[model samples]
Target chain A: MQGVNLKLDEIRKAVIEMDDVKTAQLVNTALKQGLAPQDILNNCLIPGMKEVGELFTRKEYYVPEVLLASEAFYAGFNIVSPLIKSQSTEKKTKVIIGVVKGDIHDIGKNIVKVLIEASGYDIMDLGKDVSTERFIKAVTIEKPAVLAMSSLMTTTLVHMEEVIKELIKKKMRRNIKVIVGGAPVNEEFANRIGADGYAEDAMQAVKLIKKITIG
Target chain B: MNILTIKKHGTFKVKKSTKLIDCLAKNGIPIIATCGGKGRCGSCRVRIITPQKPPAERETLFIPQSALKQGYRLACQHKITHDMTIDIPRLKKVKFTRLNANYGLALDIGTTVIKGAAVNLKTGSAEKISSVYNLQNSIGGDVLTRVGASIDGKYDILSKLLYSSLKQLKNCLGIQKPAITIIVGNPVMLSFYLHEPVNGFAQYPFTSNLNKGIFLKNPPRYVFPIIGGFVGGDTISGILQSRMHKSGKNSLYIDLGTNGEVVLIRGKNIYAASTAAGPAFEGIGVTCGSLALPGAIDRVSYAKGALRFHTIDNKTPIGLCASGLIDLLSILLERSILKDNGRLKYAVPISSRICISQNDIRKLQLAIGAIHSGIKILLHHAKTAPKNIDEVVITGEFGSRLDVNALVKIGLIPKGTKKVSFNKDLPLQGAVMAIKNNNIFHQVETIREHSIHIDLAAQPNFQEVFVASLKLAPWN
Candidate 1:
């Protein structure tokens, strides 16, 4: 048990160091040593990513470092995820997200998707430059608990409001929570656009989703 | 109560308290008011022969205290309270007869700078080259910002700013009128120049209105055709300049600027894409950043544990230009002062006023990553590896003074390319070629017809590739 704990700590350190190959190797070694995949994921990978998120928030880690750390996180997650059995039979909460129409910058959205998925949510990524009609269609079909939209440019952030107005027109506003995030988006802009919540970054986005949906 | 006299021109009666810039323009003496007489750009500066009014608060922003003390003031800020004789330094006495008959003008209207060349039509060579800051910079720093500004009903102001800058370029070149004028720029700039709506560029499925060679009758100017989306006539101009389409060797042509455009030639097929690399490469959005000008650090080298630097014109270093920034990054990486993930271990001070901060590295990383991913995606679409590329032609003002090895070391340029060369002004050269030879218009059409524009943002794997590319390390 002590040896397995040391291995899990090494796995976490490998991720923070952004060593994808070493992270994967350590995960494989721990699994071969009869460590449960669920224990490894709960004790190692998530905590590693959490530290990465904190480092990014503190500005010690930039986009490249965060991206690399995310890659390392995935390198270990991919090894242990398929082996872990689902403990809960309940249906997971669904979240639909996209970059607003006319804004193709999706890096922030991609990061949010990664963090949200790691946090155990079903994500239906609508992809970038998503139109208003498409967002409405996804909401009506996917019936997600939350609809998140992002835009990197000020010119395209208006599309977030357009999507919300269309949702209200279709009477889907009351059924789902609307969230907005991006470089140009702020609390006031989100409120002005009638979004239910605003998140400054991916970590905050995940927390916001959890608060609005589960609570 | 007041009279205004412009040296080398006739005196004009002026009303008291009227703005000197407005008064000068009213008297038919054109002053280059780049800020639209807002007293911002300082282009409308005049040297007063008589005792001038004390310098206004805004005048001190542009004019040195020594120059201000010597009776120089901003015309836009000055109100004519008394008779004044002033000299407009920018307006040159034009020799119209010498240049009117055989001279042709080529203008490359870029987002940051406007480059002009006076082509001797008979000789088919550029005689003089002049450049001016694109006055549209006052409206917005980048194309998308300007597009947003245009959407908000600042279209006329944008257009007027461009025209005023063009007039300034013409005056600088001392060309009264040319036999022919050819203009080339990115699609949005051309659209703005033609007074077309920029709505298409503001959204997905980006479309351009001007895709063919257009001739305007009033000024007898020919505007080059655009390819698609952000890949505009400037890329076509670069193609014409490089003759890449006719080359048998596989070649890549990249114009690095605020908008990085990459064109790949593989056998008979041509692929082009535009990447938004942001304004960092143009020395915007970074602390201690400036355009490639005198007093800008343009080169840096590390030897024997000492950092050596050179400024443009051998002047005191004020800030880092694109080339100097890349070189500094490479040195920092080599010395381990900067990590491959673009983390600056410490702020390295080059001068008392200039220090490279952590945020600067991040900005450059994004800019370089955008261009790197663009080149990679184009190569992948063409099914050609970087090693398969025979020649790479880099164009733009930033590329002119760039160290090719530093570019590769910093991973902005792929490492395995066979040959790399830089052309300082390909767009201007292409415009000159069009002016000298009418046959080039047919070639432009052929190139346009054969070219395929791939929207980088719409690519399915763009995010994945872009994330991988963000590393400040070399990759194949």
Candidate 2:
């Protein structure tokens, strides 16, 4: 327990350096020593991702780096997830992400999912060609912090409204924050459909989520 | 009596002597009057249970003389007379590739935007797309400007820009080398890519070596031949993918890009024409018009004589682009904010949002007029009318975003037309096909040969139609 701070530093270096095996080891050791899961997430994982996100925003990193870092983050997460659940510690946040219905496009949505998960949030990855009902169901079941919807086609962008309509029908829209992204999507489109937020890029999604949840 | 009412959908007027085609065209009703509304195509024919005038020369030329005697008339050829009813069967809608096997790459070389995509051959679907400003953008924003640049002997820079762009796209896709690549672009894009002089498209004889596909050593792929300078390979690819050839049903495929390409298919006969739609649809040349890029207000409201705009970025006020231009123009027409002369009602005190100037209206008039003239030429040659046009297939990513009702209101698309919107990432789709399917690669050869090329400038009536269509009310 006295070595908690030392383990946290090692966890930070492992995530920053994108060393998944070492990061996972440090995270497991810290959790075994009775360090708070939230502290490890906020102080180590969050800071590490913030640096990675900055690299992405500045174009220092691309889709590959973000994806690899996410893999490392998940490796560490698998070990702590069982402990936190057993101890009944409150989870940070859960999220549902998908490319909207009729839009089978996925590169953009996949990028955003990796970034969000790397930020210490649990993700329900709905994948592409997502139905509105499925989104609503996932939101109700997971009670995620945000619903991130992506669409690359203008013709299919209308389906985003269907997601919201389904949410209103289920009376669960008020309980979840909805953020939309994609090439054709813009803030106007987001506002038009009454989404809580709109991110033009994967990095922007991270920053906006922080603003929304932390605020 | 109910039939006599005409049940006009939007703002079309029917007259006793109004030729069915002219009436439909005037109302902005979408009639795929490819063949320039000529009866020669039989595409403009409508069943007239209602007594109507005898067939015109163009209709008689296409439909058998005996069939014409039986009371069938080209909608462009005959006019409605009595108050009786008639049946206008819906034309078969053009279907695009939906399956992954059909997906292919598409490279759209627009006057303003250079778009690229990766398509699937098995289903003819598209993905892995990217778009950026045509680096030749620095040369000029419109084809005419670029043509002028070519005329000035600065075509090399334009060609270099395009070549590098393709290279950049290839690199981005991680395609070290694709075995086969399909390219769809306007005549300018193709010509520039080939490093050929573009002056032919600017004047008559309007012919180029582009009717046949070409091979480039640099890209090392088979480049699809453009049907014409204006129409380009994108529309050709679209026409081919639409299967307009298979149904033997008279169909017209119009790809409204910087240059508008219109094709007419009647039975096995195919005729293609080009219209200098310019960059009007992209919002260039219009006073307040711009491309549908960021900061452009795509929709505006002038309810109760006040203005509100919804921009693309949802940010602070920005200039209007093509999507916004159509939206604003339609809203203005609906509210009578502009006079019939295409002049803004000056008395209303133009809103700050309406940056549209007197000059901009003239440009819109010219651009719209060019589109109208192209349709008329197709009708004139095909001997068809607007009403006879069964289906109007307008392709383009921009076309999907534009409100059909608004487009017709502003005389962009014909009125009362049933428009089927296809996700037009054609250049990318064509590329994807080129990469995977060897059969499609061969098909491109046949498409080049079978594609009937109509020189818009050489067509005798182009000047007259272009002039006539230039007016605010082209119908009269």
Candidate 3:
């Protein structure tokens, strides 16, 4: 308990208050005190993000506030992620997310990425306007457990299907679970496109990813 | 039938029945046709170098008198009757109707149109209101396209075109020199008016600098603080007029132009976001789309498999404006002629000559989807649901006469919008207010500083919420 002298409660409080400087300092201090990386993430950082997400849902925390908190969470995450490894002796559930081609809007994709990544998953963000071949390449290389895609414009929603078809054509579909969400995407479209699941918001997205990882 | 040669392009043969745009496009000639060959857009303009018959009434309505005298005609309306050589008018000409008064100008610069109202600064009463087409249309129709043109070094041309047009519009006030001028529009228009670099607007994390008290360097000119990224001075002006910031309860303000801006006021906090709602509501992209001018259809209803429409001036139906488009979609939904997925049961004719296409419905879907998502996101941010809002004040050309039921039917606005107030010229009114009382103008920064600029594009759940909005059925 003395080796865990680092007060995670203070770190959680800093994340809730959206204080990046304090969180970065606390995370660093906690690591120097020999607290396990897994405990630092699962107890201190993930809980902080989980609280931030809940505050977001309650409307107590808004986009800017959530953004600030995420900034703090990442400040800590940058330090803790490498050492954490999967606590269950299994590989970390890796996920990839991107906005579809022709639609460079990343507001939605960023939210899903932050929330899922904060919930203790390894996230590989492909960024916006990702091409089908690029997605095919990333999936083949990373072999992520889940592939999430977003499209804000109706014109670009078709790219999601294109990415999926490319995955199937490359015989990568069975290896990765595909989930789609965006302003123009729905569960019906997800079902029709043969995606594993669809989530409407960042909080819901994290929950969906957790469910998939657990399964 | 007649043969005509476009200046640079090759000669083409055409019949009187052939639309000039279609003829030119079919022959692989370059021309602007954002409105899908609709004469209302006035984009596909051509000048007949050879003498020809006078322009039709529709053509005269949009074309400047000087252009008409120069034998200018809209390609969408001008059909070939006899052999004539034509030239695409690259010149930007402006017409001014001088007013006889010493006053101030209040302006609302939309992406598609510019409206200027001269106020007797002493009494703070509007002397006259004059409007004209934005000259930037020749380069591009939407803000992004115009931004592209500006990024491509067309800033001077765009700025000069606007300056001359404003100069002409000022002539309508008939004042030799106005005491003051206040301009308001989306971020791009305000930036274009002053010839500022719009590079910030071209990418993510879009920034509009007007909020920091930086404005046009020219004297007797002022712009409202940029409220948030795409939501510009005009939106701040709307907030000023609505006085939503002073409210004890929750309220919503929407400026529903081509770029729909939404503001949620909860207690002392303000949240703003802009959605690219497309040009459908403004009558720029639809096949039979036109501005909210006389003879333009503003309302529509379906009865016994027939479409009944009401025009702006009780004249023959020219084209559908914003409100009429909303009504038409609702009627189609009610009659089951249009499915929730934006598919047409079949091609339905609105009038003897005008018909609705499946593509138009899809365009409307994308537009409505943008607005619906914006409202939801803002409300969510404010922690105030639609039902908690005290009032929804809509301010804009397209939003003024919009039917609440139609909007609800299409899931554009919340179903609980029982007391929606339409103030189409909120920016103009706010300008008048600022002129009458300098006290409110001082609070513009306080507003910009206090309110949060939410980048909805960054929201992780946006795709999920936006996808659900594609459905045309009423919101739950």
Q: Name the best candidate (by lDDT).
A: 1
* CA lDDT for candidate 2: 0.64
Calculate DockQ per candidate and list them: 0.43, 0.00, 0.03
Q: Against the true structure, whose DockQ is highest?
A: 1
TM-score of chain A of each: 0.91, 0.83, 0.91
Residue-level lDDT for A181 in candidate 2: 87
Compared to the true structure, candidate 1 yields what TM-score?
A: 0.79
Residue pairs with backbone overlap in model 1: none
Model 2 lDDT tens row, A103-170: 55465577688778767677889987787778887887788888899985444566788888888888
Rank by DockQ, descending?
Answer: 1, 3, 2
TM-score, each model? 0.79, 0.49, 0.62
- What C-alpha lDDT, on a 0 to 100 scale, does residue B409 get in candidate 1? 82
lDDT of 2 by residue, B280-392 (tens): 66654343554455667767666765777787767655457666666667776667766444656542323464466545665576677767777777767778776666666
Chain B alone vs. reference chain B, TM-score for every model: 0.80, 0.68, 0.81
Highest TM-score scorer: 1
Q: Flag regions of model 1 displaced more than 4 Å.
A: A1-8, A18-43, A58-68, A71-94, A119-122, A141-145, A174-176, A186-188, A207-215, B1-102
Model 1's lDDT to the true fold?
Answer: 0.83
